[model samples]
Target chain A: MALAEPKTTSQTLWIERVPPIWWALMLFLLTMPAWANDFFLFQVMGWTFILGMIALSLMFLAGYGGMVSLIQMSVAAMAGYMVAIFGASGMGDISMGLPWWLNIPIAIIIAAIFGTLVGALAVRTEGIYTIMITLAIAAAFFYFTRQNYTIFNGYSGFNLVVPPSLFGVDWRQPMPFYYLTLGCAAICYAAVIYVSRAPFGLTLQGVRDNPRRMAALGFNVTAHRIAAYTFASVIAAIGGILLVWQNAQIAPGTAGIPAVIDILVIAVVGGITRPIGPFIGALIYVLLRTFSPDVLLAFGLSGERFKLLIGLGFLAIVFFSPDGVLGLWERWRTRRSRERDPLTGEQK
Target chain B: MTLVNTTTAADRLGSVSSGNALELRSVTKMFGALAAIRDITLTVRSGERRAVLGSNGAGKTTLFNCVTGDFLPTGGTIRLFGEDVTRFPAYERIRRGLRRTYQISLLFNGLTVADNVYLACRGVSRGRFSFIRPRENDALLTRSDELIEAVHLTPWRDTDVSNLSYGQQRQLEIALALAGAPRLILFDEPAAGLSPTERAELVSILNGLPGHIGYIIIEHDMDVALRVAESVTMMHNGTVFKEGTPEEIENDQEVQELYLGDGHE
Candidate 1:
């Protein structure tokens, strides 16, 4: 049944496929340390990257797999706890004092296993049930870590849990730490984007859209979903390690219910539709969190009302742009394009 | 009259050796007290084209669903290619060379036509969990492209499935079913909601399929069904009323009285 005209398009070079705007953005991020202050570099951007990575994991599950797992924050906390327990920490009785290379991989593996187990349990149900199951699991982890004194150090966790010195550089230093978190976030972002078009990612999307259809096409829907959790957990695990290093501590509150919900808010606000959405959401969240207290005080409100402010902002975003900031941006772009004539490039 | 009650071991052996593509014995599906289909038995040989025809509520779709493992039969066994797959999951049955298209278009609407075909091809093959994007020259990619062409959807390859017309979507449905080395495919109302021109195109596509790939089509369109199918199975109230050659079923007095009526279309 060969057709006379085979309409296969010629493949373009990989580098040429990337738009010019991404190059400009990469350059700006890479050179930020040159002009930005130490506090901005170490605290604001560093926190943004860490949160972004964790939220990216959530976005991957929610956007592609149709599984809005609240367990990602807990998974990150698990990694953070793993690092503190496996590697050096102020709590010598709790810490194992393993080497960085060993402990880091161990921590990620443990968290991934935890995520896979959660996935296994969560995927047995569908839709709103998935959210509830994951939330329950996350809450359980938070409580377990708080109560388990021997393993988790109880409510008060390990402090001085810094990153290992590598390449003659103190990784805890602001500049180095920024680059570290940035590098990790970049890798996670790129990996998510690359994998989205791959068979695994595409099939996950298919599973999300029509699970029965995917199964009929010979795909094990449950397995693909569980595998998605494993992939997402690794990224969240990296973010957790980086987060613990940034704060120099890990507490039960680090992965508390509030923190877990905050990640959901961040992912939703930034837009869960694309990989870049989580980062944008994270950046907005970090900026608002960092400056909103002062802004609230300036407006004659208590600085402690930051959560209220965040809640209001979240409500506003949800009310206006249901798909988050990315959806708003897309709408704007489409409208702009529609205004211009394709043949002459003149505004209609 | 080869109605030998095959044992599980013998069934497994005979499935492959006996040339039977599908075997369903006393298959039943119940939604609470209402039995959608009950005690339905069916058999189709390898490389045989068959049409399952019934009036609305006759449980033709339910029968397809039972065979495809979308709905586990309430009681009884379904053997695919000789293996007892009664309790097997849909994906397991699919991997065993069974594929099905939904009565309604159940496609990845957000994805492109090429992506949809590619996913279907990748489903039954190895490396389904691959994290690498298929290269231009990848075997599955080439196969997907060929299937798209076979369905005459080459021009709309890059278009999103949601953007495709009703006829085009129906065509894409057939393309998806044809992916991989499917031995037995279940097409549920594939000719439904298609234009007359599209129906002819679909008939041609069905007739042009490789000889060895057998299919059981559920069609309301008599002309299209009678044209593509060599044999016919007429169902009445979730049970097989008659099974005979297309000509025999077409001229049958009971079928005409029950289904076609006096002025048969």
Candidate 2:
């Protein structure tokens, strides 16, 4: 009977649909620059948002599209390289000194095309084959960037590739960069949420569930998969651009195998099922990578043991809850709800 | 049927075609040393209702797959509405007003019934990749609702497909095939696991389809098949064994001794 009721009016008021906790979280993030120190704002939160955005792209492909692509980090790196080569950079001879407006869009478009090409190759396969194919492609990009000196600069990459001063605001400054990344990350998160319910996203999920059925329904499954990669690459490309601006540098190691794998780890550890999961995973990863060294040194152990600590934590979390932190949170919430009396809201 | 608007592109194509909804010439599918379907030649007229009857391993499903372009025929050409589509992909064929249902339910388990039907409706129509969610008055949304109601799954419209019962899933399968404006449909065992009541409802639904749309059903249930189909083509060992009216096929001595006498009921 409830299904018979009109859903439009209720759906239109999406602001009211968000939980109160999310509003509080947004408020906290908006005011973070006032309370957070420079190191925390620029290094910790900025890095978290940048990495989270990239992981979010991976989550979009893996969670919704049923494609666990390892090429996201490489796509992001490609964007970063494009910015360095096309925009002003320390490598004055190699950099063409194009306008920021021209370079930024060029960077995103190139990365998306690369991603679409990768999708064309990878979508021909399924499941584990997809992962292997994407990984191989990512590896190829890494090696190419490392060996090609003319365009990519090989070992030493371009630096001084800072964000352009727009409206007299130096965006590379801690507060501005934090806000910039925060704004971009929020837009990406909201966009993913919105598109997940759109026709394209719904059909992508259908393709994931049953490609044959989707074909029978008249959907070009391969084309949909490729389009998904293009969409994801744009997000990853944005994140990559922000990353280069934050560090004022771009290098082959930025998109190396370890870095590419880290994006996958971040997506999975954050619970690749929902859009927020990638951000949550990135926050934890950033916090651990930032503070765990000092934490280990305080215990009189070598700071290099931080990787061991991270590995242990990753193992424990995965062992306990394969869906990641979001899964655990959902389980706890459901359990709490079940314990409460439905009519009176009293704990049982 | 309201689903089959006469002015639709598929109907227009139907009118201009040679009137054969589907034509297969010397179609053959081979997997290594074994031939799944061999030298199959068949034709169905526009708006014709035909049932393909066979026992297990009769290549009925394989033949359906070949026609729908799920599996490419190793040898012959398949012409849908007078257009040779032997090299066309599954979606290409589907876009040319062809649709099919699987023997086993191939539904989006994570999606709701309404979403599933809406996807089918979107697949055939324009703006399939639109980022905007459908508004309440979206034509496709209304059509999907009509399809859901047509299949009698209105109560479960918001229910996830995985949560639906077998009979409900079967109904949804039929609704999916009927989406958009299909000029030809291939049904692989629509009543395989349905309850008797559901089978009767399915028969009624099949019979009630618009006259411009044609379908070939692969069925093991003789009663359900004969009731809905005007003609019957019996397959044995990947080849056409008999072809006649349902009554003629039922009374034929070879069909009875080889198929019916084997207790297929």
Candidate 3:
């Protein structure tokens, strides 16, 4: 037997653990809230990071498992709703008033189980069929939450689902909340990077590339796909919990059809091929969404024209770089490396 | 589907008292109104190399699919090492140590050569689906690297599989089948679409295969099929037409008329 070479390329290694660029970016993000304005800190970067986690979850499915799940936003929304319905909230009459310790894990577990079920239904299909199955599930969940009052509180969802007021600190405060979102985002990011190199993730990719071959190689393709959903759903659930905390509320609109597609847009725009593509794509989306309204108003256009701006931007990116922002980055890097190394050769 | 709770089967399974490694009885596959394979029965002892030869659409590939669990046979029984695996799923059949390669290379295009081989090796081992632990940490990683070297793919081990040449991909395909150290491996046209040099290399690879592992080489190349296999089973229109040693198969006049018709050499 030939001894095994390292399976991981440095490009995919847990996000270049000791890379100088990564360290520099980490330092900048860690210190942003210390000097930035409250709106800039929370509404801008904070929301970006939180939504980035949901996109990252989608990336895990699309990038590694070759699965596209439109129900990811709903999975997060479900976790968010669980936080309000199970724990203390402004809708105290509807809230069960359970302790945070019990409610949080229950929310994540329920979300994960729900995700796995969605995957089980969709895993047997591939490509467009998989997309349609997930989209249907997202649509069904949204309508169910919107119309069902007893369990989901109908259209006007439970509000004031605040972060845990633990350790003598108000977590919703700008500094505390920024740290919370940052920490969670970093953890999720690190996890996406790590798991992509992990055995389960590799097997999942193999299944994606060639399910027939993987089965012949003694792998349970369906099981791997379902397991992928469970893992991603839990991550999305965590993001949902953070999202609910960010907005301090949940509503039908949170898991609406458009929101379901937004996560897909974010994931693909980031280049679903790379682990960090979702975050990069998320940053561009949030910036366009947050700043374009003001830019539109300056041009005698209504603030609602941000959607037009976002649509135009999305089309431009997709047209030029179909693989999304990461594909563009990869092209530039390859060109630059060719100039520098001379003989390392361009990546095939 | 191995019954860990049942002590009786395990006790009987240890001694290989019977010589037959495979026994297919009256196997038939029907695609709606058409029968793809009709009443195919064949037996091969452990460590025996058999080749199935025929022109295209002769049900050779279909037979391979049925045995590998890609499609459940419309009728019949397939016993792998004395155990009935007719109803087992493809992955289950693989775990029972039945492996196969596709007519076209079915490799992981998104991963490196090393990663692809590691997946095959890791699949046969315990916890092939360990979520938390990276496969790099698996002891089989070393074996995967070794297999890559054995197939002369170490130089391209880190390269994405899609970048490799067709011949190299074929080598990796064989290496993947070998990585599991399977009890019986089914190769679907192992030398298909190869250059003369590549064909020579493939013949050497097949000829040098260890005797402990049994193989069923599906080949269009007469020289390759005859050289690598101890016996030949000729197929025609979804059924076994003839079975004999290499010399016996080469001289059969009826076999020539049916198999090597007007167009195909």
Candidate 4:
């Protein structure tokens, strides 16, 4: 029998310790202020957290599972519409009147089902075909929602939504709401990290690299890809729930083409290779979308130019760093380290 | 425990005395009127080292593909341990202890060589869906280490597969096939791009493996084939033209004319 090779010191160390810098960063974020007002807590931070979570779901499929999907936000919108229709406000509300717990799980499950169907079909093809199929599916769902008022309430949409409440505390309250969003985002982020390092994650990567070889090694490549999509949908669906509660409304606009594109932009801007890439991108996006109009007004620019500025930012980031903000940050750190220590200056 | 885990290395090797690890009975596959491999009936007995020799379009690779479930044969049956597995999917056949190494190294380039072997041993220790971390499988880690050591690649085990030399990469590929402890290993041109010395080393290693690990090596290198394989099957076009000991094949006038063409040089 061949003997086991001894692991190197670096591998051994990485296996043993979780780096201290990450912990320090987490503590710093935890101590930051809840926010000075609802605008910061609920509107800006809340949207960022939810959009970031949605983008993170795409990251799981694209980066880890080697699947590109344009329907993640569309799936989220399905959950949003489902919640509105099923919650105490819309069509199902009057006809069925189900409790909050039952409604939310059903919304997520339905969104997951929608996501699984999309995944099963998209996974049949690869590369550009996968992208096209997902885009088509998202577009079809958007049109269906826009035209059907009885179910999705048509283009007029649905309103007067409420998040589940516990102990008489409105979880949707600005501060409480921000915490809830953060908590969910944190869990999703942690789960992505854990899964990426797990055996299944490595095997998924292996499948992406060489599906035939992986198949011969006993991996059901299609099954893994679909499972990955399903996992991504679960997170996106939760983001959708939080999003509807935040706006107290659900609309066809939420599931439209532009919203679907925005999720992709967020993933690209954050560096789709890493899970936290979405969060970084989400912060930049939410800040821009929230303040773009005000910033344009200050510059004597009209509302029409707000989108132009956002577009320019996207172009600038992509042009300067194809991997997005995370890529730029990595490059900057490597350059700084090289300047400080010329002996060992290579970047991974 | 052995019966429950029929795919395990010990279980597969234990059943070697029962018969050939793999049997192909009149297997044929066609793609649009072009017969890739036709009416190929072959048996690779347990503990046997068989070499399938042919030139470029002799369907050597095609036969390996059919055996490994890369493609289902259009006709006839394939048996693993006296049981028909003609319609099994690639993963299912692999689970039944049948594995193959590709002509081009199909290793995970981004990961370490050890990680490549670790993946092959992954399904062995636990189910394919095991959530256990790579570090948690000490038995697998030990097995992978043994494979790396057996291939004399302990020094480069931790290095990325991309960083290895061509010969080392080929060796690592074989190591990966061995990692799963398969009952039958199909090598598709194992010595394809290796140096003469490297080819010699591969033959030695192939010869050294225990009797339980049956192999069907597809090769163009006659020297390597003669050294390692216990039996030889020569193919012309897509069908086997002759089968016997290497000496018998070397002396056969028909094999020389059809497969070798003109001279034995």
Best-performing candidate as measured by DockQ: 2
Candidate 2 error regions (>4 Å): A1-12, A342-345, B9-16, B262-265
lDDT per residue as tens, model 1, A1-348: 111112443345668767999999999999999999999999999999999999999999999999999999999999999999999999999899999999999999999999999999998988789999999999999999999998998999999999999889999999999999999999999999889888899999999999989998988988999999999999999999999999999999999999999999999999999999999999989999999999999999999989888899999998999999999999999999999999999999
How high is the CA lDDT of each candidate model?
Answer: 0.89, 0.90, 0.85, 0.82
Q: Fraction of true contacts reproduced, model 1? A: 0.74
RMSD of each: 4.7, 2.1, 4.4, 3.9
- Pairs of residues clashing in candidate 3: A1-B146, A2-B145, A2-B146, A2-B147, A3-B145, A3-B146, A4-B145
Models sorted by TM-score, best on top: 2, 1, 3, 4
Q: List the candidate 4 regions with Cα displacement exceeding 4 Å.
A: A1-21, A34-37, A90-97, A334-348, B1-18, B124-126, B132-138, B257-265
How does chain B score by TM in each prediction? 0.92, 0.95, 0.91, 0.91
Candidate 1 docking: what grade? acceptable
Model 1 misplacement above 4 A: A1-10, B1-15, B262-265
Q: Taking the tens digit of each residue's C-alpha lDDT, what string does model 3 give over A1-348?
A: 112334444336655547898889989988887789998888877888888899999999988888888989999999999999999888778899899999999999999999999999999898899999999999999999999999799999988889989999998988888889889988998787767767787788788788888898888888889999999998999999999998999998999999999888888888998767888888889999999999999999999989899888889899999999998989998787867745666453
Ranking by lDDT: 2, 1, 3, 4
On the 0 to 100 scale, the lDDT of residue A116 in model 2 is 91
Task: Report lDDT (Cα) of residue B257, candidate 4.
Answer: 79
The sequence of per-residue lDDT tens digits that candidate 4 reaches over residues A72-139 is: 99989988877887776645533245688988999999999999999999999998998899999999
Query: How much is A131 displaced in model 3, in angstroms?
Result: 1.8
Q: Which candidate should be chosen as best, given TM-score against the real structure?
A: 2
CAPRI rating of model 3 = medium
Give each model a TM-score. Answer: 0.95, 0.97, 0.91, 0.90
* Predicted complexes: DockQ each: 0.48, 0.58, 0.50, 0.44
The interface RMSD for candidate 2 is 3.5
